[model samples]
Target: MIYDLLVIGGGINGAGIARDAAGRGAKVLLVEKDDLAQHTSSSSTKLVHGGLRYLEHYEFRLVRESLIERERLLAIAPHIIWPLRFVLPHDKGLRPKWLLRLGLFLYDHIGGRKLLPPTRTVDLRQPPHGAFLEDRLTRGFEYSDCWVEDARLVALNCMDARERGADIRSQTECAALIRKADSWTATLRSSAGTQQIEARAVVNAAGPWVDAVLGQSTPDKPHENLRLVKGSHLIFNRLYDGDHAYIFQNGDGRIVFAIPYERDYTLVGTTDQSFSGDPSGIAISDEESLYLCDAVNEYLKHDVSPGDAVWSYAGVRPLYDDKSSSNSTVTRDYVFELDKEGGAPILSIFGGKITTYRKLAEHALHKLGGFADRSWTADEALPGGDIGASQFAGFLAEAKQRYGWFPADGVHRLARAYGTRIDRILGDATCLDDLGACMGGDLYAAELEYLVLEEFVIKPEDALWRRSKLGLHLDRHAHARVADWFAARKEYA
Candidate 1:
């Protein structure tokens, strides 16, 4: 079957494009070499934010667009994306208080100023601040952003795309692209075998490997548009008591965040360094770990070391290299390279953050020039995002009452993870036993079944790490149990 569009890579951008294209009535096929979000997409700092620091680089357009999408994303997927308040403290020698206020003012107003609350000043000597921060920090500003289940966002987009008739194939690699005058033939290899498929156009959204994919298509040209920047994070056992996150300004001009993570831990992170090694093999270096520790140690009342971290993750941002002097100063906005010279067109995506993926998709389709005349995904809620924007708390309350047999916290987790689709897992089950065997924590066989059947989960890691951060909450025994379940199911099949 000849598809109208073939999307390569199953990260957020690829998934978003497939979802948008399929919703526009195009015959779309999306292929990924590995499990979805197994790389950069899942390795985010987990925020739907308007790069507040980008203001210094005069990235007003990118900031504004990201800020606008921030709210839209929250409204559409309130379950996975919701508001977060960040505390930016006024330090003695770094960015001045007036400058911080100015940035916050621009941040509060630039994106049309709706839905989220405006920025406000706070005394650092107050309870939440004084208790967590150093005695030297006496004042700060609080502003809004949003948090996202990064990998889940990718899954939901692909899920919506599949539901819209797009063929979503995980663990499938496009080995070769044979372009013709009017169409292109793709050699796809998977566990089953290699097969050929045709598409009118191709989209190369391979996050870190964009250039490699482009190299395959146009072997004669050098594709060096990407500047791989590695960002790493550390998760510690609850660094603070509040739900609010802190953005600390370092003396070196970088910022680090200490956020409430996984309900029981504090997430700290993100060092920007130019990476030159294999993207897949990247991990938090000892230097990066110490840098992050020191960054947070400057502001937090209590000190922490790398040994205190419970977990760490690293992802390379596939940024568009604009010859920036520093890694942190590079643009986060996306750039598209469209090749239509010889025959069928292929659009290669470079350097986009998760916040603007939906808009990126719309622009991609428009760049391709023939998919749909009107855009439709802007107002559409992703699957299970149908719960009213402000209604998640109420939804969780009702879910707890209806599934009273389950732990209230478990119900809340499910409601947040699956949103309105929690009913699909709970169904008519009247008790915890009804859900199926407990693998560990609140994870049950029924939930795994729902993920496999609906969310394209292929392995235990996909379910534990990407589909949800249950890996952080579950024990090693539970991890082995989850693996065994997958193994048994495969054997039975």
Candidate 2:
């Protein structure tokens, strides 16, 4: 059967488009060469922010839409998305506090402003929350944004797409694409070899690799002006005691972020250096690593060393080259170029973030026109997002009361991760023993089974890194043990 729309790439944009298309009654298929979000999506700074700094570039439109969506996503996915405050320490070298305050004021009024409070002024001299700053910083600002489990966001979208009847192919690469009269046929390759798939239209949602897909699908068309830049991040043991993330202005024109991550760690990142190698050929350069560590040490009382880095990752952003002199000055907004002259239409997307993926997809699909149908995902809940027909926490409490026999922590864990879907995942389980087998660090065989039978849980790493961040919690033995088991089964391959 030919799918109505075939989307290549499983990052946030690809997954978002798949879920949206599938929900609109289209027979959709989404293919990912690597694990979903293994590239740019997961490696992001993991903030669903409005790019408050974009105001300096006069990119008000992007900031407004992003700010609006930030709040909406937080409300819908409170389990994986929640409010986070950003602390912008004032540096006389950077923009004045008045300008920053003006931007924050505009940010506060954008969208989804009903629930989250507006920005607050902070005095570094006061007690609580501001002690981490250097004494030179006498005042600062704090505002609400959102923090996302970047990898889980993709997994959740994939799960939702599957539930909505979208065919999801993970670790599957599209070898070739040919315009077959009025449709497109794609040959997909995997460890098992290759298979042919067809679709009425193809969406080139492949971040970083979008150009490669275009080359295969429409070699004649050229994106003569395109830029792929590599950004890197480092993870550290928590440096300060605060729920708020910090935004620092380096002496250079660039900026750095220090976000509280994994409850006990700080994630700082992102250097926009132009990259010309393979899109996936990304690494954290020593300059970037030291730059980040130095930026943090300049602000915090506790100094962070390269030795403090527990983990580091990199990603390439395929930004639309605008001939900007500075890489940082290049726009973070996306551009969609369509090709309908070649029988079947193809839409190629470049430069978008997780925050605006929903709108991006809607606009991209609208550009596809006849190839797509009506949009229905604006307010639809992703799979496992429906806790019940009531208040999410209340629904969880009801389930916990009913299945109170399980470890209270386990139930609360489910409530936090799966929101209202805890009941569906829990089923009739009434006790810890009922959850089947114990894996490690709150991981049980039951949850793993659910992920396998439901979401595409093939490799142990997928279960550990993507579906959950239990990698940080699971002991070495637990990781080796589960990895050995998955290798023995060889199910994911």
Models 1 onward score TM values of: 0.99, 0.94
Error of 1 at 122 (Å): 0.5
Poorest 10 consecutive residues by lDDT, candidate 2 = 383-392
- lDDT for each residue of candidate 1 in 24-62, tens digit (9 for 90 to 100): 999999999999988999989999999999999999999
Deviating ranges (above 4 Å) for candidate 1: none
After superposition, candidate 2 runs with Cα above 4 Å error: 371-373, 387-412, 488-493
**Candidate 2: what lDDT?**
0.82
Q: What's the lDDT for candidate 1? A: 0.93
lDDT of each: 0.93, 0.82
Q: Alpha carbon lDDT of residue 128, candidate 1?
A: 79
